[model samples]
Target: MTDLWADYVDASPEQAEALPARGPFGDSPALADELLALVLAGGKRATSGPPDPDEPVTVGGHWVVSDGSDRERVILRTTEVRAGRLDSVDDRFAADEGEGDLSRGYWLQEHRTFVRRVLGLSATTDVDDVEMIFERFRVVWPPEHADALD
Candidate 1:
């Protein structure tokens, strides 16, 4: 299978670039594709990381987001980064995630499962006050192409 970014880099060494990326939910490719689609559609603008004091992706960093097959789909530029307890996530950020009715209740309910079921965190661990990294980013690739006119 073709690695999209590698092929691009090979074709255009001067223009092509690479950045860090990972599947949306660790190694789950299917969910990664779905989440990437949400971003592409302007439905998802932010993402949260698991409880970790050390931030992984930093502000002003770029990411090459990929799909289920690990094919590069979009480029994302981090615009903001914040860290806080998961329970402190407000409605605005939850809604911006574009998932499950766009409600805080939904975010909490779904994230609980995501943190446990998907991420494989300790099921016995208390979720409240867990350190969470929130990142806001902007899509930088697949520019809205439009026909040029004279």
Candidate 2:
């Protein structure tokens, strides 16, 4: 990870002073790899989850996305951030996620399951009441990877 960051800083001199957040998607190795592949293939552009108090995402902030083994794959620049109840997720945002059937119904069902397992919510808990942070981003590094998707 450090080497990847160094290389990025070296290539983009303007970002030499920037400190970006770094992490892989999902809670496990297999899931992280799956999501990373989706991002790389231009199938995913948005994600949502519980807010992180220590590393709140901001528009224009950079993030180094990694794979299952922690190999940095791309740098993503945040374009938008929205906070709302889980039930508030809409069709547009769901399609932007590029997952399942790219429908709001699929998103809701999948997220409800995710929340229950990952957030430790009981089956009876109302996932609609949970707060969620939705973030939209564009890949910024490795021009070829970003360009191919475009």
Candidate 3:
């Protein structure tokens, strides 16, 4: 099948050269699109993912952020990647997510729901202080060019 994000991304050789291999962002296409919009709007600078203690988190890696359908959206260059307890996700980081009122309370509620629903866990799962992989990234593709994706 044709790549779903082909229309939404610039796939020129130069862009590809800098992109490396990029992984999608969210559990669903809608959620990926939602978060990608925030990133493009300059409202989101940070994100969190399920923790993998055995795997190394690579900083300075280029990732293709995608929507739910697995379509590439924007290219992200990881600036920092660290593991932290979910409970330590403070107000500042939550606010940087730029989602839903930009409050820690909202972040917790929404993220908890996302973890349980998307990650396929019990509704009664305790995530209060669970381990998580937190990452800070910068847009590397479109931001470097003046032209729009369309």
**For each candidate, what is the lDDT?**
0.70, 0.87, 0.70
Per-residue lDDT of candidate 1, residues 1-150 (tens digit): 656446545644754544545444334777787787788778888888674434377876666777788676766667788888888889999998888799999998877767676456787766767677888887655455111222
Itemize residue pairs with steric clashes in candidate 1. none
Ranking by lDDT: 2, 3, 1
The reply for model 2, stretches above 4 Å from the true place, is 147-150
lDDT of 3 by residue, 1-150 (tens): 444234224554444444345455567667777887788788888888677545445786666666667766676666788787777788988998789999999999988877777667899998776677878777756544222432
Which prediction has more favorable TM-score, 1 or 2? 2
Q: By lDDT, who's the top model here?
A: 2
User: Which parts of model 1 are misplaced by more than 4 Å?
Assistant: 1-19, 22-27, 51-55, 118-125, 145-150
The per-candidate count of clashes, in order, stands at 0, 0, 4
lDDT of 2 by residue, 89-147 (tens): 99999999888999999999988888887899898888897899999999878776663
Instruction: State residue 15's C-alpha deviation in candidate 1, in Å.
Output: 10
Error of 2 at 139 (Å): 0.4
Lowest lDDT block of 10, candidate 2: 141-150
User: lDDT value for candidate 2?
Assistant: 0.87
Q: Model 3, 110: alpha-carbon shift in Å?
A: 1.0
